[model samples]
Target: MKRVMGCHLEIEVIDPTEVELQVAVSGAWDDGQVVESLRCTLDGRAVDVREVRDPAGARIHVLDAGPGRLVVDYDAEVTGRARPATGTAHERSLYLRPSRYAEADKFFGFAATEFADVVEEHGDDAAVLLPYVAAWVGSRLDYVPGASGPTDSAKDTLLAGAGVCRDYSHLTVALLRALGVPARLAAVYAPGCDPMDFHAVAEALVGDTWHVADATCLAPRSSLVRIATGRDAADTAFCDNHGGGIQLHVSQVHAIVDGPLPGDDLAELVAIT
Candidate 1:
């Protein structure tokens, strides 16, 4: 089996003040493998870790916070999980809650319009629709790391035609939802990636299960790792409620698989500075 890993960061601070925070880390991997376990530390203090598994992928979240300089460390090893055949309608429709879809006035206009068209054009088949959208977004946008924020909307990305993974995933989710597909964003640490590292991806409910797809990875088939998922990047953010200012520094390491190595397995890492 092949493996990939990396890390990322998202920090914002305005000055001196107390902050509340919660962070989640996610990635994708070959299914049917056992994720040995994961350990995470925040601000030099150990945080609580939670695990959740779904058809789309497996995820781990670190919930904790303190004062200035938030530091984090995490490691997990996942084995392959069984996957069901594709081409089935999603059992449920994801309802967009008012509170969840905040800042509608800004996101609903052009962003929603363009996304709706894309979905409508490819609604008939998942195989065709999924990759088409993924490639379209990845190819159309330039990966400009450190130039976007959590609140950046689909319109912002569409206008600039360049952004980080969060922007890419957000735009993808918006478009998927507009086309009547239940879609969400995932925050993950890629173990071996670098530069444009720690990443986010988009997932849409197709057939009876959720299928993972990232425009950034150009529709990561079964190769990419799995992490956490939420309605958008905000829901699956790496850090919790932090009020003061935020700063992020992320790194990754990708290696050709030869055998098991000690320490961390996933390439994605997230750090708040």
Candidate 2:
């Protein structure tokens, strides 16, 4: 389905002394999906822009500024595509390894024990294992706002037994990798998400194709607008700043459907490009 979605965010920054700020907000791109009608702006200016494409496909905007209050707005039209599991071995090897937040290696023992039977039953089918890992992790954790910080890892979330969207994604991604599935974290603008903040989901490469999974199930997966994909949150953060104690004031995200809502009559797992 072709979906029209975007996000506008206004942030207030305060630096006692004068300081330069460089902001990197994820931009829409073509991977297995295509983004169109894209627009971006910084501080109501015409976007005196510089683009830096990260290794994982996040578009970074390096702004020139001596900040007081900064506003960033981004919008795009996303055309979904069918993603086949056809990546080369090198591509798959990257996500198969552990990352700072995912810590797939740390949870190897747990995953082996918990998902051992499932892996045995499904063999090499990531399609079956992806949903199983999502459902299993989702059941084990409770969603609690402000429960985890930006640096928190899957181990932390598992110990706490609760977390926000990123935490759920981290744990699920970790578990999938432990079971030999290549998975990465995806930052998105989820249209129906409650409170409407930026959201995070996992993309598991199974059966030679990449599939989207949201253990939190906060919004319909079809409504997700891909912003960035990385090994974990560290690489996909909406804002990566280089200086000062800047307070985040007025952070919000919302998306309107171009047409009537798609019926959720399909299965629980929502697979998308």
Best by lDDT: 2
Error of 2 at 186 (Å): 0.6
Query: Over the stretch 92-113, how does candidate 2's per-residue lDDT look in tens digits?
Result: 9999999999999998899888
lDDT of every predicted structure (CA atoms): 0.50, 0.72
For all predicted structures, in order, the TM-scores are 0.63, 0.83
Candidate 2: regions farther than 4 A off? 15-47, 79-86, 264-270
Question: For candidate 1, what is the TM-score?
Answer: 0.63
User: Residue 127's C-alpha lDDT in candidate 2?
Assistant: 81
